[model samples]
Target: MNIPDPQTFTDPEKLRKLMANAVRLGYEDLAFNCKLRIAEIAGAAQDDVIEREFWTALIAAEEFKAAAAGKTSRLAKIRTKHRRVGAQRLLADMMMEEAVSDGFETLVAHGRAELTCEAIVLRHEDQFSVDAVNAARKKLMDHGVAMTDIAA
Candidate 1:
C-alpha cells in the first residue's frame, strides 16, 4: 500500500480513496482505525487550515519534548509551545468534531473497529519500553501518521 503524502493530502475524494485503500491493504491506524481522525482534516475545506497548523505545531512540540527528555530549558520551551497549541486545539475542537463527522459516518457504515494502541500496549505491557514506543511511533509516522498522532 502506498502511503499518501502528507503535503499532498488535500483532496477529499482522493483522501477517501486513500483511506479505503489503506483499509483494504490492512493499514490499521490512519487507514482503518484512525484514532486521531486525521482523515477528517485531510480533506477539510481550505478555511480549515488552522486545524492542520495546530496539529503540525502540536506534533512538532511533542517531538521536541520526546527528543529533549531531561533538558530543562528544552522542556520549558515545549511546555510553552504545548500551552499555545493546546489553546488552538481547544478552539478548533468543535470544528474538528464537524470535520470528522463525515469520516466517522463512513467508518460506522463500514463497521468500525475499536482496537487501540493502549490495547496493544496492555497486551504486551510486560516488555513495553520507551524505546519500543518510540520505535512504533517512527513506524507509524513513516506509514503516514504525524508524530503527534502516535501516543504512548
Candidate 2:
C-alpha cells in the first residue's frame, strides 16, 4: 500500500533514494525519526553539531568523488556531501535492523505482542519455506517448542 514519489537527482543524490523510500512507505514520520536518530549518532547533540556533521560528511563525499572521477569542481563537492550523508543514513539502517531482530526474538520468546515493522514482515514472508519451517522445528526439539501452529 506504500508508494513513494519519483526520485530526484542532486549533486551527490545518495540520500535521495532513502528519502524517496520513506515517502513511498508513507513514512515521513520515519524519515524525520531517522534524521533525528542519525543526528544523534553522528554526535550532533545541538543544532550546530548536526549542521557540522552533515557538512563534514558532505565534504568528505565530495572529495572521494573528485578523487574517483578526477573531477574536483564545486558541483562535485556538493554532490559528494549529500551522497555521504545518505550513505551514513543507509548504514545506520543496518544497526536499526539488528535492534529490531533482537527485539522481535525477545518479544516472541516472552509471548508478548509487538508492533510489526516492515522489514520483519518482509523477512518472514521471504524466509517462510516449508522445508525451512520443518528444519526450524527440528532445531527446536530440545526447547520444547513446535512449529505446528505456524501461519503461512
lDDT of the candidates, in the order given: 0.37, 0.36
lDDT minimum window of 10 residues, candidate 2: 112-121
lDDT of 1 by residue, 1-152 (tens): 46655445554456556656665777745443232233334324235443443343333333223323423122244336446664233433322222322222222233321112322232343444555444434433433444443232
The residue pairs that clash in candidate 1, if any, are none
Off by over 4 Å in 2: 1-47, 73-152
Tens-digit lDDT track of model 2 for 45-75 = 3254224443333343333334335455234
Model 2, position 53, has a per-residue lDDT of 47
Provide the global lDDT of candidate 1 against the true structure.
0.37
Q: How much is 105 displaced in model 2, in angstroms? A: 30
Q: How many backbone clashes does candidate 1 have?
A: 0
> What is the TM-score of candidate 2?
0.21
Model 1 earns a TM-score of 0.25
